[model samples]
Target: MPTRIVVDPITRIEGHLRIEVVLEGNKITDALSSGTLFRGIEKIVENRDPRDVWAFVQRICGVCTHIHAIASVRAVEDALDYRIPKNANYIRNIMTLTQFVQDHVIHFYHLHGFDWIDVVSALKADPAQTSALAQSISGWPLSSAGYFRDVQTKVKTLVESGQLGIFANAYWGHPAYRLPPEANLMGVAHYLEALNWQKEIAKVHAVFGGKNPHPNYLVGGMASAININGNNTINIERLNLVKTKIEEAQTFVDQVLMPDILAIANFYKKDLYGGGVRNYLAYGGVPTVDVRNPDSYLFPGGIVLDRDLSKVYDIDLKDPKHIQEFVTHSWYRYDDPQAGLHPWQGRTEAQYDGPKPPYENLDENKRYSWIKTPRWQGKPMEVGPLARFIIGYARGNQRMRTLVDDALKKLDLPLSALFSTLGRTLARALETKYSVDHLAGFHADLVANIKAGDSAVFNPDKWDPSTWPATAQGVGYCEAPRGALAHWIKINKGKVESYQAVVPTTWNASPRDAQGQIGPYEASLLDTPLANPDQPLELLRTIHSFDPCLACATHLLNREGEEMLNLRVI
Candidate 1:
């Protein structure tokens, strides 16, 4: 008999998620990923002005704020067949790259770091030995023995008082945690350092977009103005401030983040799991010339299936047959339960067919999750850093190929090792470093464009409602920090008729489709061996690698007589 285990409201992720797995002995034989909340942000933006969609849709997730706004604006622009200025494109690219660097670092240290790191063990680490270990890894300025001693003292205070705060509710002494006390101490030190450093880097978003979390964006272009001599606008001093922040971010990635990843990865080289589906997708990031041209993207877009590097398929976002969403195992209703609908014709009718609250198990044979199953050409695909890296390496991008090769060489691991849970984690760190290296070039280009007397940021040619066509539709996409994200829109009489956003987590956390194929999260967990079934630390290690954000994956739905169900799992 297989043991059924439920880890509801998965902690440290963005929103409510329940993961149910069936364990035969110590091995996971099957898994189900559930998004308990209803995601209906599309219904919220219905019949609104196309220009204002960016602001409303951006509120989907606080962590992934800017990307939604970018995608929404691009969708509106695409519908109108409008083109933005080069400077606006550069500014948008800069904002995105900055977000990637900041988001990835925060995910590794604060959100996903605890999975592999044992914070309690840091209390027993020798400060001198930890300092030596930290120094051996990188040239970080705060690697003195006294500094390590201070960090250890802090952790001791938290543990002794029984108020671990952010460090609470973790499987601290689990057998799966393999890092030594010294390495754990080093990780804890940087964890706090990253907490302090995160806010400063966010100032870049403020400098460009006016605020963090919910940054202001314009449909035609950016809302920020450029006047080199003006203090109120994006002038010389502000641009220089942006430059300084980028440089600081690059330094931190090189010295602190990369070294820590390498060190932690070295300890768990052989504990490989969570490589799912082996079908990768990236919608190309960081546009150099324009978003329309795939050739100019920093991370080129393509699809690689079954771990094949020989052939990469071209993706068309507008083609109906290319991408479709199925709700066969989802909590929504369609006229035909087995039919898959594209975003332009996607429906969001609320229908609950699962078990009531306090239920021990979900009817997986029926509907189980609020997340829709998104398939590329009728096949499940994994998206994110690993996908981007695999696609880039397959396409023979010299920089991407060289970076992945060097990292594998340092770890003495083969290229095949990159498809596991560790590979997803390593890909994110590597992509962060890669993004930082390109940050300077974008900054330089921005400065040069401003100096060349092109200060235009917004394109007002088609800004008026009178200039719009009676009916139009478009798709906007971005390779967000998590993976590929896009928003599809249909407009009529200058108002949104239909709106749908197929986010990154939806792709990775989706349930089985009409064809009965499990999603990336479920597929990855199959055959994974759990040392102890009671404490599912190994499940977390693989799931967190995708950096699951349910807030973005599942939006809210308002229905009369519908009571919100909140489950407290003890």
Candidate 2:
């Protein structure tokens, strides 16, 4: 008899989840990843206007809402063939850069730290001792004695702010805590620093967004405008402030963030050789509509396989027919399994598509699932920080390459550094630092263009549905913090006929391999033992690493207490 593994409602990330591992005595033989919470977002947006998608999709992710809104607008613009002003592109990039900074800081201290390090570690830490350490490596700010008192007040506000999420449970003495005390203290101080870092960086978005959490981004060109000092064409002071902040943040990235990642990995040397996949992908980051004719766009999208970490083999995203979705055992319904469909034209029917005689078999095809397995080039792939890290590392540009190489060396190994909790946690930080350091150069060029008075605002009309003579389709794939993600949109009747979105977690936390082979999560659990049958830390480690967000995914609505047309076999 196979052993049954049970994990009921894993906590602390974005959504609800259940885990079951089939164990043969002491070892796991199989795994089942259950995404039990389903919010019917697709049906909610059916009759809404194309523009309202920004607000609707923003609700999908509490942390990365701004990106969702921007991506939606980008896709809609792509369908309408609208050309945005270059100024709009610059503003959009800055907004995204803010989100990236804040998201990176939060990921480092709030989300990933709770699992391995203790919150109370800072409480026991000597203020003088940590301050001295900081000054030694990152001096001046704490050069005075009074500054130490100020730091204490800052730390108090963060821990007591109650805004960083419910992390009191993640403190040093917590029952599940693992890392040594000093490391916890070190991470906690960074936690406070990160909170300040994100809030400050958020100003960039606030200037354009009206506010954070969910910002205002108008579709088909630009919404926010740059104004002069009430008497000029531009607010040179404010713009320069933003420019300065980018540089200041970059300095922090170089001096502190990268070094911290290296220091932390030094303690967890085992992560370098676990769960690595030779395959990689990127949804071609940033826009490349001409400023530089290098053809090597900002984030060149493609599929990468191991043979050398440097070369990435990209798949053309312009070809919609080449991409397809399979909802085999998922809670979706389609007439055929090989349905070459994207989200815009996709359907989510909760009924089982397979024939079944009873409930015991639990055949995936005959079951209702909250998640739909997404495939690229007919196979599932990993995305997010690791994929982005690898892809950017392959680019081997200045800052990204330096930060990544240092991290790789710290893990005491090479390329295989992707698969475990440490890799997942550290990759985002590396990417964050890289972007902060690089976007400055991009901003400088934008300002130089403005100083030269280029007046390069390329805004076009909102969007004329009738004038859209082309019916061609495309998919926009981009790497999010979690993993590989893409949006598939099909336009018809001057409206969105079908829209499909496949997120990073959809690839990483996926249930099973298409041929019924165990997935990465399941495979990782093969030999791991649980301390108690009930509290499976191993399972939680893998799931949380994906940073599961329930709202981001689309699920079927339940009638009363069950799926409307659930099928079962016994």
The predictions' CA RMSDs to the true structure, in order, are 1.5, 5.1
Q: TM per model?
A: 0.98, 0.83
**Candidate 2 lDDT (Cα, 0 to 1):** 0.61
Q: For candidate 1, list the clashing residue pairs, or say none.
A: 39-554, 39-555
Instruction: State the lDDT of candidate 2 residue by residue for 494-542, as single tens digits.
Output: 5555566766666655555345533444445566554455555555655
Q: Which is the leading candidate under lDDT? A: 1
Per-model C-alpha lDDT, please? 0.91, 0.61
For 1-570, candidate 1 gives per-residue lDDT tens digits of: 999999998988898789999999998999999998765678878889999999889989989999999999999999998899988999999889889999999999998999999999998899999999999989999999999999999889989999989999999999999999999999999999999998988989999999998889998889999999997999999999999999999989999999999999999999888888879998887789988888999999999999998889989988989899999998888899999999998887766777878789987789999899999999999999999999999998999999999999999999999999999999999999999889889999999999998999999999999999999999999899999999999999999998999999999999998778999999999988899898999999999999999988875464432434443444
Error of 1 at 398 (Å): 1.1
